[model samples]
Target: MRAFTALINPIAGGGRATRHWAPVAARLATAGADVRVELTRSGEHARQEAQAAAGAGRVVIAVGGDGLVRDVAGGVVPGGGLMGIVPAGRGNDLALALRLPADPDSLAELLLGAEPRTIDAIEADRGTPGSQGTAAGGVIVPGNVYAGIDSVASEIINASRWLPALVAYRLAPVRAIAGWHPPVFTLTLDGVTSTLRAHTVVVGNSGRYGHGLHIVPPALVDDGLLHVMTVGAGPRRAVISFLRQAGHGGHVHRPEVEIRTAREVTIAADRPLPVGADGDGLGRLPITVRIRPGALRLIAPPPEAHAT
Candidate 1:
């Protein structure tokens, strides 16, 4: 039997994580897994517990949203430990990208049987002091790191936690776009610098954000490179259209959208812009983001099962 530690965020997904734990635990018990449960008090607490559990040779399973998964990865990655996931939070984008099963039975089965695969992670340095999202001047991003309109939407989503996920995610962007202004952004990709007036800049590893928008459609978690996307300044209608097409990854074809691949990217705006990673705020730019290829060892569905 494999030893497992479930680090749960009870409040994630508006308390959905707490609700999902019972069936998952029962299934794990039936599978004869050596399992332990730890309800996380905060992001830092989750990271600490995951690190301790990983150090003790347990497969640390994050039973929450992408933010919790990112927190757990911060601990598991540095120690080279194995990790698993159960999608129990709003915008479980990492789990979605990995094609993790949502039903408890299949999820438990995957946890018990899937092989650990090496995947890439983003290491973002905010270059200043921050909260739970940053440690030692940086944060581990399991998905994409972004700023501008999307970051404002993230703020709205975070504040509107009482609303349903669908409502919050859908309405937040509209609210953000209404008040947003195009900012002058300076981007340095692998040491090549350029300036542009854009609505947002995204550096992606897993490529999905804003509840399944393919902000960087060509990004792959194990690609050993970062996909940098810039959404150029445009009319509100054009920006809205871009976001709509992003759900199907059609936004990449737009002339206003630019995609580039690099191992490292540095972003600086004319003024400080809010930056977000894995659906949580990570302070403001200028921030430096780099791809840490194969830094995360995740137990996920086989490559053939991955969603396109």
Candidate 2:
């Protein structure tokens, strides 16, 4: 079988997409798999390439970060092609969510050897009502259900000038400290709509967010359920407590945090909201997010990592 590996942003992880290809190519060559490597010129290039190969004929591995995986996965959706990971992207949230090894070699083995399993991928975007806003202002409805925190998305959009995305996140909390600029949005989950002024809201497919943060750690990737978490800045003591738990991946019990589950969710605001899912930017809000179960097949760690 032919195995094509696409490198998505490798700037953060030792430029593995371009730098580590030699060894990986040799290994795949030795294994008798026609391992072809491709360098993505921009954000969605990998997705385009994966779309070109979607089918039972090829096994495509996302050799970069979660963004790359999401792109390729989106492209490979509905096809029988197999997928794997090679965590060379910043945050690598999807990798962390799946418990895949950070090392490329181990991941390569899991990629080339594992039994392919189908998983769910929620569709996310910004720029309409319910999660997206129109110019005049109206919620753009979603056909699927997904959960996400606009705070991270806002940071990425605000930091787009930075060539390396991770650099922006490293400085986000500090930037957020100067003065609070949390956006106000209406979150609708399980038919209950609540307006929340929040610093972050995370919609999770599987438990985890940037670098293993348990924003919705109990989310499962295959349970056909989506997890929603809205984090607001409560009292000063609460903010400190939130930060401590956020840093350790155990912040669920905080009172200021709202957690819910749904099959479809709507989040919208008067202003454009930035969004990131599994780790990719959704540009701006006025958007809709919904879960698309069994949308893609992923090879990764077992159920605990997938327990929604």
Best model number under TM-score: 1
Q: lDDT of all predictions, in order shown?
A: 0.88, 0.60
Measured against the true structure, the TM-scores of the candidates, in listed sequence, are: 0.95, 0.81
Task: Give one digit per residue, the lDDT tens place, for model 1 in 169-277.
Answer: 8899899988678899999999999999999999999899888887787888988999999999989768778878999999898998999999999999998889998
Candidate 1: list runs displaced more than 4 Å: 128-136, 305-308
Best-fitting candidate, scored by lDDT? 1
Q: For model 2, how does the per-residue alpha-carbon lDDT over 93-211 read when each residue is reduced to its tens digit?
A: 66766677755576667667877776776765443434222222221111122222335433543455344555554455444445556668788776778897776666778666544
Q: How accurate is candidate 2 locally (lDDT)?
A: 0.60
RMSD each, Å: 2.1, 5.2
